[model samples]
Target: MVRLADVAFAVLFVGVVVRAAVTDLLVPASTLAGIALVVAVVGFSLFDPDGGDHAASLVVHVALVGATALALVLVLTDLTLVSRAVDLALFYLVVLALVGYRRAPLSSTISLFPYLGAFAVVVGLFLLHSLDVSPGSGLAAFPVFATLLLGVCLFVVPRYVEADFLLRFVGALSAVIVLVGLPSLFVGSYSLPFFSVSPWSNATLSPWFVGELPVLRSIFPNPNTLGLLVFPAVLGGVVDLHRTYGRSGSVSLFMVVPGVFLAINAVGLYLTNSRASYLAAAVGLALYAAVVVIDRRAVPVLFAGLAVAAPLVGFGVFRGVVPIDPSNRFALWGASVEALLAGPTLLGAGVVNTSELIAPFLSEGLSGQSSHSSYLSIALRIGLVGGVAYCLLVIGPLIHGAWRFKRVDVGMFALAAGFAVHQLFEGYTLFQYGPGSILAALVVGYVIASVVPEAT
Candidate 1:
């Protein structure tokens, strides 16, 4: 009964995500169903007679549920800051759920303190800034909050989610994204998460692919966001492909299925024509080969493919295939760095303040978009101390557990490496609050969990 209830809740959560995306893109929905499901999960989590006897959880459950209920009311009432408050409520529920996840004692957490503590300092600075400068800018804490979610999943997942659960979740998510998005590319487009690229209410986003060029986004707002969302799944598919072949040139179900899945995933990515994503995939695969089992046969072919793909992508970028010019990237980066230099050296600039600093350098008065690089974005938002702390919070665990990279741990390492590389130029997986980064955070934690423990 516990397993059934948990699966139901997960399924409903995924459904809510899909519906919410569609609602945001096309027609607006009340979103009351999403709230109803959240409420239902709370009930199932606490009072199911056949569920596991978590006798000590009653108080925590009640408090979280009460807070969520209150947030739901506020969302309906159209309170401005209530959405962030609701997010906070949801975050608390996730923490309580992870912490209370059966015989997993506090001791399982000893190895996590340094990383968490470092992140805590970053969060402390952000919270202080959020309070001091833009107190109403509750949404500004997204990057740190996303990082926190990833940390919790990383520390608690090995104790809770097993191999089968992870595989199914990743597989299902990839399929849904690919299948649903493939059709939209050819037929029409919808509203994006940030804003529309097309003048029409239901047209493809800016520089959207046409004919041979797909420019697909699936459920996300743009092709770039879609690329990040599918990256981990692609990595997993590659790992499985390597795992399937044998020394005797043997063929197995494992090799065939994963190869097919990856081919499909690659098609989805290729159609997007996102250069950063292409490079991100290569970075991930390289780290995977270095740490985990290396398929001597796959490396050369993969390299050859990357060689061909990279130059083509670069040519496209040089030719102005994208709406944003290559030169503007440098301009944006320079402005961001200057703002960081001008802001507080130690404690750093306030959350969302970097946008204000950069607006003078941009047209149309753009503000609050990430500085294209997570590293720069953090340095721009917080001080050097916070920046260092944020880096340690995200990458420190992998460095500390470097020795643990083996077998499946390679996949996690590869995923982390891809995300690391991508953040150098694009920062969604590292810094964002949209639907694209939502799943990416869980991927971060799951990968961290896989690599952090000796035999996990």
Candidate 2:
């Protein structure tokens, strides 16, 4: 099993790195590259040793490279969902491994509550539409329904897993995103394939055209996604670097090495001009430095308190807890709540057209801003209860874990802080974009794993 596992992992790593460095090499031959990646992820999960030999066992690691590589290639081709398919395949592999071998993933019944809450909201809302729930015009269509369940499932994965696998996944993903994004620094703005030097092809979005100079989106279509993808990894890598090459008194040389790479990532995120991500990265880095300055132990309490309060407090930096009068987002939030109340009693109008749900909310004076808040979007779509469930089911465990790790690891908590802080403005959840969902789940999962008690 060990030898087979080694061979499988070796094949997977070589194949994925190739796929990343160069994409769709098998294009004319079909998406054989994609196929190979999915197969490798499955194989890694099945053959890797039990109890993981690490401090904890996690299933997310099996498909880490596979999933990340697939995502890169798909973007190069201007695609979505194809890479996520690798995660789906890897998940199925985990299911089969558990069924055949009874290898349990770190089970969390508490995580199931969010699922139930979301399910109840979906069901109750749909049923109420038949009874003509007020303030609502029609039920959520097919897209919203798919979103409701799909979002829940995506969030559920890490909650049930061990932390080691998920964190390794985060670190690896952060590195890949940084690598892909580096091209923008040199080439300015071009697709992964970048076949035409001519800018008017309409085939790809060149960031340079948006401005007089290249801002860097790397392989992604938009600067916002690039910022979101690279920033968290930058934060996480800093934390890991300290632990790996860390020493007391003076800053470690090892810290300088990763710092150089982190600087590259920071530059990429900066050139994106993704204001929200830039702000988040700044905050995360500040927290990282602050932890270094102060005590690591205070991170949990401070972060937890902030996380708890951020949602309620009204401030421009905090993603607008309550929309001010006449603001675009405020108007959107008002409309979405109206629609939610009118449509379904508990469940949201389904995941479909959640953005549209707030359309009526946008006043002519608001200047075309929709719901800029992911927090509001969830509550508006899933109903107030579903939103609360998510806060508990998803955010609760991870916050708890971050608090626990405050005793030992400050970096992880700070990275988590950056992620949570940024999402307030941008929708990086699984349902929002490819990397967003994966990163969000793993962030929560790893933190939760940190807090879990070992065998008594």
Candidate 3:
């Protein structure tokens, strides 16, 4: 029965990816099929009274149910674009559920400090953003909160499951992402109107043009949406390389696949002209390389130098340098800081509509949509207090994990460091929908599991 469920889960995953890939061509079919598959999987687990008993497993089930509830609410509320929200919530829940059931922790589940702390910070930011603004801005707080919660869940589940099981699932997910993304490279166009190429044929528009390469949001809706999946694959590949190398063969091949992914993603960002992703990817790679060097002192600086240079080379090949536009980003940051200093009440720009509060003060060209900076976005929506707390909540565990496992567990440490840096540019802590959120969750889970000596 478990094996049958696994098969169904895989089918559901593929269906989800397919729906995203051919959203334009098969909206009704993809939507119905994907939604049905998710319902089936959830139903199967809930009805199976014998479905394992473990804290991690329980967490997975609860998370999935919570996500499903959120999706239903969004759809009922007429948020059509929120289909991706359903996809993301379901995917993480499934991952955690599978990992948890397979492992069934031998000891009590480790402390929830990592998850709790992250949640507190997110809440604080939401409150801070509420000060001058209405309380509605707090609604925007969900994505970041969900992202951090999911990360905590992922990191903890692997402690009970066999490493091979986790790797297999991750590998399968990676393959599906690649399959979904490949079609976008050739077929149809996906555009974000806010950042679309002007005076160009709509046929030429694609997320790859804007630097959202790998998962191919153009095939679906948003490029950053796809990044939710791709980011985790990158981390999974890193973990796989570590595991595989411990057994045998040249680690070089393992490194190449992730390298290619990084290259492709970097190019996508350049094409999209998303400076934030480009900056995030550049910083992420640098940090990952730094972690690698710190672990394997024998690796020559030449190899390290090449890793650093590869993205620049790829950028030149794919998209020539575009003019930099920091005006809006800087303005948002400045305005958010000023708003926070105005007072200490915690009412945020009401719920989901922060734009109304921002429009009056924004520059001519800047849209009040979102402050490009995740930090500023949180401040504007939640407030300075919430923003600061959120930062600590997100980073504290990674810091704790790094300190606890630095000497003995290299893989987890590297992941924590890589993610920590990635957050600097991309709002991994802010959005719950895509690969970034899942990756953050996985990293947190992995860190918790790795640091717990008994579990390791």
Candidate 4:
């Protein structure tokens, strides 16, 4: 039954990817076949209660992958109607899966209060503010809401969805992105029939790099997105290498696959030239090393060195020794802070048109569509209360795991930590429906399941 579920997931996942590409190519037969596969998968899961339990994880898991793929396709091609149709289908499929699993233990539910509460607060504020917005804006906000719903669904996956399946899911997802994205740097085109490139670039972001270098977006909408999307795969590959080496007590042929995978993804990450992602990757890998690679007793020394080095690094950057670019983010962040201070302190403006929400507060000539920071974006959209909830949602697992150190899966926890810091500069956290958001949901859920005794 699990094998059947796995086969269905692969088919549906491929169908989603192909359906997005061909939907713009006007291939209705292929598109309809994809829809049919979705129906068959859902029907198979629903009709066979026993099979449904086995397939439950696939429903949410595939939905997130499908959602991100469709979103990117929608941006690069003319598939508005197909994207909406698939989105609705996947949303309902998840809801139905949750409905079937009505036996969730109270302990599991309570363990996830941070995630659930954050979702509720964000949605509540959004609804209140969206009520006053125009219909188009309200419609635009639906995807953000949908993204959060799918992310939280990660926590409730049935017991039948084993850890092995989860590991395979992360590995496969990373492999696909890295394998495809790396080749795209040389072979893929950003032109019509393949993709319609957005005119966005790092050059436009700051005066410091006006024409210094070209941004490598690869198959993604932007470099930053691509960088963030590849981050988890790198972490996962690292964990695989460590475990393989530990089992053999030496680097062997078994370690080569993960080593190569990590190296490729790391290269891809560097090519993206996304500084935020660089910081996130560094922070996550550092934590993984501290917890898993280094002795626990020596951890304080390592952190103390970092504490001393951080101020020196900052001072160097401040003194023009590092030549790093701020990318005008300070202005954007200031505008958001100003708007938050102006009014609507408790329940913020809304998730829709967040850039537009802060535009009024921007200094005379500065411009941006987002706060560029997920933490700021959430606070700007749902207010301080929601921001705190989100923080807890991202940080609670790490804290709990650290407190009960023996039970923690440090690899998963470090991935979550990377995501937590990644959001400090990027907006694809709980409120955004992108690849990063989905990965964040999966990693955090896996960490919670790892640490909490009752959750497993």
The candidate that wins on lDDT is 4
> lDDT tens digits, residues 1-456, model 3?
235444443443455454454442443332433443344345334433223554455555556556554543442344544353453344434433433332324453344444445554453333333233322233433442343334333533333334444434655565444454454555534343322212212223345345433334434355554554554455555556556666666666755654565445433444343344545444445545565557544223423454466456545534545455443444665555665565333534423444545656667676554544455555555665566655664555555554454432445444545555455444335334234544455555555555554422
Q: What residue runs in model 2 are displaced by over 4 Å at the alpha carbon?
A: 1-214, 247-257, 308-313, 316-327, 365-370, 402-409, 431-433, 454-456
Q: What's the lDDT of the predicted structure labeled candidate 2? A: 0.49
Query: Residue by residue across 227-263, what tens digits does model 4's lDDT show?
Result: 7666777777777778768789997997676676677
Q: What overall lDDT, based on C-alpha atoms, would model 3 receive against the true structure?
A: 0.46
Best by TM-score: 4
Winner by lDDT between candidate 4 and candidate 3: 4
Per-residue C-alpha lDDT of model 1 across residues 254-297, encoded as one tens digit per residue = 46656666777877766666667877887777766754454433
> What RMSD does each model have against the real structure?
7.9, 9.9, 9.8, 8.0
Which window of 10 residues has the lowest lDDT sum in candidate 1? 195-204
Q: What is the RMSD of candidate 2?
A: 9.9
What are the per-residue Cα lDDT tens digits for candidate 2 across 151-240?
322333323333333343445555556566655555654554532111212223246545344555555555666676677756766666
lDDT against the true structure, per candidate, is: 0.54, 0.49, 0.46, 0.58
In candidate 2, how many clashes are counted? Answer: 9
Misplaced by over 4 Å in model 1 are 1-20, 23-109, 133-152, 184-211, 241-259, 290-327, 361-370, 406-408, 429-431, 451-456
Error of 2 at 125 (Å): 9.7
Candidates ranked by TM-score: 4, 1, 2, 3
